[model samples]
Target: MATDPIHQFQISRIVPIEVGSLDVSFTNSSLFMVATVAAVTLFLVLATRGRGLVPTRLQSMAEISYEFVANMLRDAAGTEGMRFFPLVFSLFMFVLFANLFGMFPYFFTVMSHLIVTFALAMLVIGTVVIYGFMRHGLKFLGLFVPHGVPGYLIPLVTVIEIISFLSRPISLSIRLFANMLAGHITLKVFAGFVVSLSALGAVGIGGAILPLAMTIALTALEFLVAFLQAYVFAVLTCMYLNDAIHPGH
Candidate 1:
């Protein structure tokens, strides 16, 4: 039987379990998340196990990833931001690996789900809120108060700023979720066309050529998008962390 394209996105329980009112069952999504984490951990551990003056390919790649995220944090939030390098780097690697892994056949796209992406977004914004208050105390409220505005306009501007600040997690989650969902759906539709058209006749087989070509092209584009989205997530994270560090203007 031809499987449904949408079925790829469905969350199925591998082991059903519950505690009180909460359904904390083992699921496909949960499995992929664990695999993603293990893959990243093993990649870094094995890559740097033999750190030497003459680095191997894995070592070089690890170093590049490290420097790339370090430079990103440095540029976005400055030297003080290096303190959060573990947080920023972990987020980048996790998202990047999750995105890339999802491109494989039969692998679940974790970030394609709204709940997963939303949780990640909330984790980021929550960190910003917690650290912002802890680091700057009540001064963190200054982030919502713009400088050099007229007294009469300050109230309106502050309200707008507060709304914008609150919308960060929503915007962040939606961007990742929508992009992944749309890209995968488009790819699936095109692929289905290839399969359906090939079954009709000789003419239909010839007609499938266009969709096949487009599918190939889209596959490449999706790879680029996967990397770009992960980078964007990490970059925005650094920018938000900057607010925690300098919560003014």
Candidate 2:
């Protein structure tokens, strides 16, 4: 009976303030984005405010997070990328918070949408291009050439490399979007089954209990998925950065 996609992902005009032509409507999705950012900001700010010698729970969380991104950069991109740790860490935290916040019963899943994921992917690809060109000047285009390939195979390998490089955004965005969409839709379908069966008599209602339990279990599983998807996005982005930094391999 709930048409609102489990009655959770509702789109609404929150502020009701409209510009002359801009029509800047504040949506539920926008509100959830703000909440996610605010929550993350508070968490990091409070967690590391004093930098205690004896780590508190919040401080430990902050330290763990810092080490995660720092080690990721160190392992994947080496010392040169240490300078870029802030960028990478911010990206990971933002995406992670966005995905985790969406797992709440009524919160909006920002990364579930293709446009949001695509925009983030575009940012990653754009950064790679900019950094590559900045580091290598005009020679950055040499990235498309295969290093060990013979002279005759250079053309074919270059074409494949070009396709692979160009498809980075496509690959990155699709992974997040498809996973989120599928998880949410599958949950919704199970929820519908629970509701429909529970509406009938005692036997039918008892039958619905199985799906109800499954839905609850799946909801918990989805929480894990939300975090994993965000981490996957960040790790893949870092891997792409590695390619840009040391190309032709």
Measured by lDDT, the strongest candidate is 1
The best candidate by TM-score is 1
lDDT of 2 by residue, 1-249 (tens): 473464564468898777887867888878877888898899999999989999999999999999988888878887777767777887888888988887776678887778888988999899889998888776778888867789999999989989999998999999998888788878888888888898898988999999889899989988888878877887887887876687653
Q: Report how far residue 47 has shifted in candidate 1, in Å.
A: 0.2
| TM-score attained by model 2 | 0.91
Instruction: Tell me how far the alpha carbon of residue 36 in candidate 1 is from the true structure, in angstroms, after superposition.
Output: 0.2
- For each candidate in the order shown, give its overall lDDT on alpha carbons: 0.93, 0.83
Model 1: per-residue Cα lDDT over 117-145, one tens digit each: 99999999999999999999999999988
Listed in order, each prediction's TM-score against the native is: 0.98, 0.91
How displaced is residue 122 in candidate 1, in Å?
Answer: 0.9
The Cα RMSD of model 2 versus the native structure comes to: 2.1
